[model samples]
Every structure is written in C-alpha cells, then in structure tokens.
Target: MSIRSVITTADEQVPFAAVKERIVQAMCAAGLGAVLLFGAGFSSMETLHNAAHDSRHSAGFPCH
Candidate 1:
C-alpha cells in the first residue's frame, strides 16, 4: 500500500469527536487526581498520610 493510503486509513480510524472526547476524559481524570492529591495532604488519617508519603518517595517527589 502507498504512504498516502496508509495515512488516510489510519486517520479515519479515529474521528475528531472521538479524539476530543478522549482529551476531555483525560482532563477530567487529571482533575480528579489533583483533588485526591490535595485531599490526601489534608487528611487526618495516618494510613492515608503514610500511603501518600510512600508514594511520593517512590515517585521521586522529595518529601521528607
């Protein structure tokens, strides 16, 4: 198959609306993750704090 045909076929597999929806979903997921991160920081529960602390260290966030 020619390069143009290959490109066109790949492009048709995902519609613009589908791409936009995926972007929106990704943004919403990220927002929720940020909220959870903030909530974990303020949580009074020791388990939550310890889990978040360990995860931060694993992710190289430099939390003491």
Candidate 2:
C-alpha cells in the first residue's frame, strides 16, 4: 500500500477540538506556574527591565 493510503486507513478516534483544548489548557497551566514562580518582584516596568538587563549582563551579553 502507498503511504497516503496507509495513513488514511489508520484509526482516527480522537477529535481535533479535544486536542486543541488540551493544548490550550496545558499552556495556561504552564503560564500560571511561571507567574507564581517569577511574578513576586515584577510589580513595575523599571524593576522588570533592570532584572532583564542584569540577566543579560550575567550571561555575557551586556547591554551597557
């Protein structure tokens, strides 16, 4: 059998919408986890910018 015919013959039991929903839920969970971990001192733009600058410097790509 050809590749397309073989693939078409395989069972497709799962719906596309269900797969998309699961992916969205996973992404939301990951975003929430990141917020909980790194949202403590990110109350202001200046603080966030400074933290990013310091990180870049530490990583040897200084923006000074």
Candidate 3:
C-alpha cells in the first residue's frame, strides 16, 4: 500500500466571505472586551487600573 497526500488541485478559490466573517467576529469580540475593560465593567477600579498599568510597563509603553 502507498500513502498519498492530498494537495490543492488549483480548482479552489480563496474563501473571501468566510475569511471576512471570521475577521469581523474577532474584531467585534475584541471591541466588546475593550469596552468592558476600559469602561470599568470588567473589574473594580483598582484592579482595572493596575492591570492596565502593569501591562503598559511590561510592553514598554510610557505610563509615567
């Protein structure tokens, strides 16, 4: 018995609609999360502020 690999036969076009749907979903989720965090709905004031502050420092963003 021989094993074979299935490769694209050049008949398939890029699935643009599917790609766009996934991209839009991801962006929406990120936007919702950002609103929750920045709007102080995700946690208390101190926790949110400290988390943002620490992340900024770690990422080398000016937070001073």
Which prediction has the highest TM-score against the true structure?
A: 1
**lDDT, ranked from best to worst:** 1, 3, 2
Q: CA lDDT, every prediction?
A: 0.86, 0.82, 0.83
Q: What does each candidate score in C-alpha RMSD?
A: 5.7, 5.9, 7.5
lDDT of 3: 0.83
What lDDT score is found at residue 5 in candidate 3?
Answer: 38
- What TM-score would every model get versus the actual structure? 0.49, 0.43, 0.43
Task: Give the true-structure RMSD of model 2.
Answer: 5.9
lDDT per residue for candidate 2 within 1-64, as digits (tens), equals: 7887557444666589998999999999999999967785556878778888999999999597
Global Cα lDDT for candidate 2: 0.82
Off by over 4 Å in 1: 1-13, 46-64
Model 3 clash pairs are: none
Question: By TM-score, how accurate is candidate 2?
Answer: 0.43
